[model samples]
Target: MLRSKLTDSPLLKVSRPVSACSRCRSAKVKCDNKLPACTACEKAGREKECTAANDQFARGKERSYVAALELRIEKLERRLGYARSMKDSVALNGPDEPPAGDPNRKDSMAFIRAAIHRKAVQTQEDADINTLVSDFGYLAVNTTTRDFEPSESNMTFARLVLAASTNEPVPTPRTADLPAESTARALVQFYETNVIPIYPVFPGTLLHALVSDLYQQHRRQIRSSEYWLFWMVLAISSASQSRSRRDEHYQHAVEFVGRALPHADRALRPGYGTQVQSLLLLTQYSMLDPAHFDSWHPIGFTCRAVVDQGLHQDPPHIQQMGQDALNERRRTFYCTYALDRAISMVHARAFSFYDEAVCVALPSPFQASSTLSGSTTAKRSPDASLPLFRLRQLQSEWYQALYQGNPNEHLPDITSFIWQKYREMWEWSERLPPDMPAAIREMLELELRYSYVYCIASNARGAQVSAYGKLLIFDHVISYVDRIYDIAKLAENAAVYTYHDALRVLFMGSQFVAVLQEIGDLILSGSSIPSPAPGKVLPPPRPVRLDRGTGDDLDRSVRCLERVKLTLRLYGDRWESALSCLKNFEGLSAEVWKNLTTRQAMRNPAPTGQWLPIPGA
Candidate 1:
């Protein structure tokens, strides 16, 4: 009966019905789109005959608002029942909540206020959660995880990594901390010229827009990602050029990092693609500013993001995406891949994931975007990062085979395999585009030599390294140490060299010294060592030196050892960790260094009017 009465009511109308009543349609008159009855029908005294023409219901059985009204009524009825039940519960003497003779609830108004307070606290908690979620820019980060909630404790991924890795707190910036607009632009120019060509994780256009917006337009409207990007670019560019810990560039880099961290909670919020990019930028900055942030921590986070996001593989249904999306995804993944390989190798640690686990293809040809300032990155050749990406892949392949997957077992043809790897890298280096910037080109060349020596030097694998292999290590390490030292001593670094480079120097120098210790005669004798497999592809020939220094074996070896010290000492000025590497290297080679000094001293003889050669030469 209730249903019938509700359906019969002419006022039972929806906000906007789809069609007129049957009578109104038959009469060929305009309809008000009301339900149950048309106004024309009521005026015609035919209200009993009114029915919607296009109702998706049986006759005499439907009301337009039935579901909505019934739901509302049910809710009210439920609340009414609950309110009656709670009437006594809200009282001071309520048996459910108040303890016997509790002084806290002695006053009647106190109990009422207590009930209201309890409800407000719940509502406030929910509001806080919502506000927190919204502040993360909800689209970029998932704040729904219970552990990350404020109700539990104050902890976030950003805080976790920053705390673990940061050795010193970045100084908070003052209003005067910002450099002049032109100075900022020049720094950005440096980053694009040196850093972007190697990583290319983000589009240049977006950075350019952010720089213009920050300087010319209102800064308040800028987004968190924009601010993070801008600040990190400045920080990395400055820190990369810093030759001393006390330099202005280093100080300014720290200041910019401090400014960037406030925006990091949002920028690095996980569960979004931007998370990987943001982490990559942090890794780049951390490489330059290891005192403030550890590159290892950020790169580890980035690799985790890549695996979690399935960026290690090509998209299954790639055609569904736009070309630009596909390229950016691949580019970002490869950038992370490259950094992981480089950092892990530098630290002499295992890679986050092996090459067999990753299948992402190289990104498409680059489409350079012009910065607002109209410089750099734009002039570089497209696909400038591909060479580095390929080299990392090659490094990963052998590093995994030799050091990680099965370090105990020797490969079936280890010698051939080593030479093959060197050949592949040599080809990669030889193909460097002539049009590439000299700075970036030089950086790639350095990486190639490092890889060659790193691969050839048999560290942990059980097989005894042949004399030829040790010779390869000797020559390549010399080339790498010499060039890298020159670059480190420059007033301004042409490329991004970091504390990681210092670590590499230690490793290469150690290898060079170790080879000399074992075979000081054969290596320093200027006599060629035959390949272990005479018929097979010969081991890479000795490095053809451009300047064969006029010295015997002992003199050359001494010079090499001294250059290693000078290089580490120079890098030590920039990174505190490099100083640590220097000390450690000195400790490891104490005996070898002492013997070399004694030998040189006895041979050369004191004050026979024999003066030492210039250190720089």
Candidate 2:
């Protein structure tokens, strides 16, 4: 037999809302849909327990999640302020306050009393606030604290993160014999020379220890993290050295990665400190080998791991921890932070967390472990990564200001803001340590140019960019494309170049095409650009001699565009996803490429029509 039950309360005798509170629904009873607490719950002494999931959803999701969180926090603060005021009033007037364990203290917050004569009466809003405040403690999860053993649960945080981020699954590893001891040593040496200088995520000695444990003794039980560290170093070193996917170096990289995957579940076990290191190693390899894993995902996961375990915050005091361990922790956080900023900027996405969220200080330079005597700290580490980390901080500030800021919210005096950012980055470039490695210095220089163009162009709500601003963008992008093209042409990577470099080239090329499309004639006319009238801040001088000796500006533009394409093509040789960059840029600028070619041949070309006008230009 079929039966029907009423969805709302008939016993209330008045109009009823469509749904029942959680307490009523569980007891199969009618509920009058009073907010904060239902009538049935109140009658049953369960008013504090009343909840409606739908109401929470409808109200909580009405605006942006971040905005909503902010609003709720503000409301909570106001309530706390009111509570403080009430306590102050009591101290001044001697009004009796609720004692500890007062029945009302458990059921609701007290101090609604104003003075000795006024009686306390808690409103529904107070109850509502009390219930909502409890929600603040909702998410108390630590990825490193949970142990999902094979017997307990099939899922692990690492698998969950990989499941989301993996574009192409890492290939199943072969159970082949390990590489010769010398071969393994060479890969480690290359990594120390090229990669470790910029990303000292782990101490140099750890990799060596893992190697000795694995290659020489083969007697000790190795942890999952040890296996991950050894293989990922081999993979990243091999892949970075590989110029072509079909090369022997690339083949060995793929093989090493296959060997590493078996341990990822354990290595990436979520509630442990080792997970961050493992994720970091994977992130580095992903940057080099985008065909198997997207660099973006692993870095995001790594940042979350760092933040979850409070690694983003510096220690309270030196006496609480060893100096080496504290420095390593800080270095680890900054490396993840740097990667997050760089990746987000290249992709034009929001950072996992803003610069305001990170409190860790820059770490001391970490020198590679001395191989001669198996002792590290032979010479103070060259401060290469420190500069890179600083640049990311600078980049994050302006990138968030110019690009990530609200599109509808106007930035006051945007021109001065951009110029100021440009100047700060330039000064940073000038102050780079004299002994910084050539390749590392070159990367930072490229980053500087990228920042200059990025900040000058206002794609969001900002002031109109004058012709001088467009000229600034044109000059910087021309310099950027020229340098990246040279780097791409090298037979092997000097520093750790990755697919993101290709993306950076593509970004710079787009700006190059944009300026040429908007103000091609004036730029090519080689007319001197007037700098903004000096205010409290000064505009950067027009790029000196960078564009002077070039061919006709149109010719330079075409060369820059083609060089951008070619650079991506070269990067594509090592990382397949870089070819996607090549493809995307080719599609986007094909028309501009053709137009520049067509217009370059003419002795005098008239203004081209129908280009998307630059937002503020």
Candidate 3:
């Protein structure tokens, strides 16, 4: 029913008149609403720059977006300026020919500029990769999934996303706000004596020189990348020492690393040894802060830097080079290799560099007697790291065989494979020097034991057998558990345990508790188990000295798990992973205790001295 009356239609609202000219709007300054140009832009001698806001601009009100765009434009402008300056320099210098007499410095200056240009380009690529993959979208998922289907890639991407999403913004450190000299010195000293001995990757003599120079001069005078590297190293090492200062120092390290990163590309152009050392230190320290965006990413760049420097190759004139430089190159390359292998293991990613392509020598078996400035003397000594690296390399082989290969393909049965690896690891341990320091020996021995337990327990389903066989394996693993606890106790007494060491022990201990809980379940179920081997007969289960576990035994196990939890908490401040591990242990203990308490309640009415009968007896 349309009324034919002359109803007035709503007036078409005119588009809101542009309130501020584009320049004024961008700067968030007031515009006088003047025609042709705003009064603010005219007064600022930018009259031509003022224009009406674009009607199509959808996000004009977003301050952050505008700011980001402005920043990008500034960066482009600065880069343009740099290109112009470089062009001028090239023209003036005329390609940097060697001086007329001595020809040793053949086009050295030209090469330096070229290298700097190359690194700058590479640095841009590194940054771009981060921006491209930071979102962890379908691209990252698809790429990783395609490379490693039904394998670790999906989990790896998930972890990376977890790491990224949970990361909190850290405050940038001001150079003027460094720690007091005395405090800095003490921390550095602790690092040199305690932390450096374990990794032994950084050159002690070179570090001494850097420290001397740093303290002797003003911090402002030494604003180079190497100085920043030293600052970061000091911060991370100090963080490892005390919980009270851990976060503060780690934050400082993070900030310093960020500032030094832009200079990293240019610094490497000099062919100076500090560049490699600094990158290695950063990569190593990054491992501790798992939540950092660049934590694992820097390792890839470090490897590229190493390869660019030809560090993987042993020069034919190695003897002619400074002995210190040569040895440092060797140490740095192996350390990188070790780190690469470890990261691959942790992230389940493929190793960036291959061992077959490596040609660098292993670090000398003996300790460096004096400074690098002095004789690079070689003497016999019990170097624990030599064997440790060997063990790690051996461990890496297992990873390659298991993960790098197709998961669907038939491989060795888990038991036989594990047993073979165990035997090999045991033989490898035998080769370590008998007289090695207890500090080193204990950790290495703990790793071996932990590896055994990890392998057996990880593949427990594959080793399924009758109840008696599970009991025998349980008995064997329990002893290893006891050994781990004993070692942890010793470590508790000693102040030398690093976060990495504690984390390893806690991880293994937690798994051990889990295995025990599983075995307990099997005992209660009274279920028949198939033999691990199809046709082959297993040896009769070994007779154990211990009797069936009673209430008291169950109570003891609970107390042991509680002790492990308490130990993990001791390290919670220095290592965030400790808290996560503690939570896991708590859950496992709660479940195990609940089951035990119920069993105890059922048995309460029976004789106090009676013990639960063994299943499958």
Candidate 4:
């Protein structure tokens, strides 16, 4: 009866506090322990800020409960250990009546020994389990499971938790600190390792997951300014190449930029300033992928924000970083160039919106009427209006000339306009005193060179024709070489000069020859003609070489082929040189020869043992 009464008593029950605050429980009426009012009072339209005190008594109770549980577990473990020790001692002592020379008895004893050992092991294991549980409370099981075999996702989660708990910074990967070439190589390696192998079997989700992981991993390593820019550029280039998977890559890259943009904007280093431009370029590239267009509106917003911010602020210090010192100005120039390219790409891709601005001259009749007076139009003679027609005719001619292989086609109207602009620029140059800054001179020179190259490549009669319809195409082969030569001559450092000179000879020189050979083929084929000479007798059209023997023509072909081969060798695995050569021979017959030779050399033995020398050798 006493036991029953004790069991039924309120003291025997485990009860928790009714309120977290003692003051609230003390009040007969419901009290929030807030400074002035409770939730009920506030809900009744009373303006009050709640100020509740922490329940110290409740915390003490929780601590005592946890301690008691731990003590109980420890006492149980100790009792189990003692019981195990007694069992082990009894097993070692064997049975009271020993069966001498009996194999069965010996086997029984061995079994008992084995059982004793196992029990000892189990006891130790249990002790360890108890210790772990006591130390880390409920986390012991999870920790043990993780330690057994951690998956990538689990590891990432663990790392995030650790970072959060300890407020630790994450380590940057080695590839993240590498140069542009190294970064590109790493990206290629990642694709080869992760993407290429499963490409045939897993065409969709798995491949996308791997690529997404790679993008995320790379995004994390972007610590330094250079690496960040490199990553952005590499991502764009990689996405560009991944035609089938471009949309997936584009989305991943957009997400990357979205996260990085805030950090990049706050960065103060000038060398790292290129990251803004790179991010802009990435946005433009993402916009080009149709799948991402709808989801990536933030790209446009970010780009405009960056542009607005950069233009409004002072120019970055281009000459600060050590490695950048050599090409500081060039890097700065490229930063601006990249921005322009991004803007141009966006304008081109989103044509419907920007097309009107670009085609200002082709305004609607109503719009033209609004801007022009009838009296002024009446005063202008019909013949005077002929010049406008003439300009259009000339523009069309220029377009045709550019398409064809003509090296000297000039659109009078366009050329005249360019010349007028050039004259104005020259006047501006002259107005600059002799003591103008070298940077200003260099800028003017670059502008002049760029404009000249633009005109030469675009105005050439056959330039557009052979360019295979790529707009704004030009013979950069010759101009690139010329610029390299010019830069080499002016370079003060011997190593820099040699590098530039070698690059020029290896890339530009070979490319110019290739294009010239292509032009020769087009002329010989009688498929096209050179531009008309100015006030000079037009050369009789050369007959097409139909049955051209494989003798001198073949020999010349072999030499041209050999020249390409030798140039490739001289360059020695130089991709820029090879790429420049390829670009120059874009619309040419010589490219076929070079490509075939290269392919054959890769697949089989070389026909000729001797390498050909550079032209004029």
TM-score for each candidate, following the candidate numbering: 0.72, 0.72, 0.58, 0.26
Order of all candidates by lDDT, from best down to worst? 2, 1, 3, 4
Count of steric clashes across candidates, in order: 0, 7, 0, 10
How many pairs of residues collide in model 4?
10
Number of clashing pairs, model 3?
0
Candidate whose TM-score is highest:
2
Cα lDDT tens digits, model 1, 1-617, are: 32222222212111112345667667888765333455688788877888754342344543332233344446556655565466556644443465445556556565665567556544554444333322221111222222332234345556644654465678878654456889788887777666776789887666766777788745658767678888889888888777789999888888888888888766766565567888888899888877676666677767766765778788899899888998889999999989988988887877766665577888877744223122543553656788889889889888877887555454777767778888888888888777665666777888888888888887567657888888877778777877887877764444457778888889989998889889977765668788665535567776787447547767767777788899999988888778888998888777777777777766666685777643223
Computed on alpha carbons, the lDDT of every model, listed in order, comes to 0.70, 0.70, 0.52, 0.34
lDDT tens digits, residue span 1-617, model 4: 32222222212101111122333334434543233345444665643433233223233322332344456668767876776676557655433433234446656765666556666766666555445333332121111111212221222212212211221122232232333444444443433332221111111233334334445645544343333343444444344333233245544444443333323322212223433444444343443332322112323333333332333222355335344232332222223333333233222222001111111121111101111111112121111111222222232232223432234535444434433443444444455435322322343343333333333343334223232211111133333333433443343111111112233344333334444444545422334344333222222222233334543333433444444445434333222333444445433435556544443345455469866433222
Q: Itemize residue pairs with steric clashes in candidate 2.
A: 143-270, 143-271, 144-270, 144-271, 144-272, 145-271, 465-616
Model 2 CA lDDT for position 108: 34
The residue-by-residue lDDT of candidate 3 on 34-115, one tens digit each, is 5566668878998777765432233343223223434555665676567657656653232334324334666665556655
Q: What residue runs in model 3 are displaced by over 4 Å at the alpha carbon?
A: 1-131, 134-166, 174-182, 217-223, 244-272, 291-294, 308-325, 347-349, 368-381, 412-414, 457-506, 521-556, 588-590, 597-617
Span of 10 residues, lowest total lDDT, candidate 2: 1-10
lDDT of 4 at 474: 19
- Ordered from best to worst TM-score, the candidate numbers read 2, 1, 3, 4
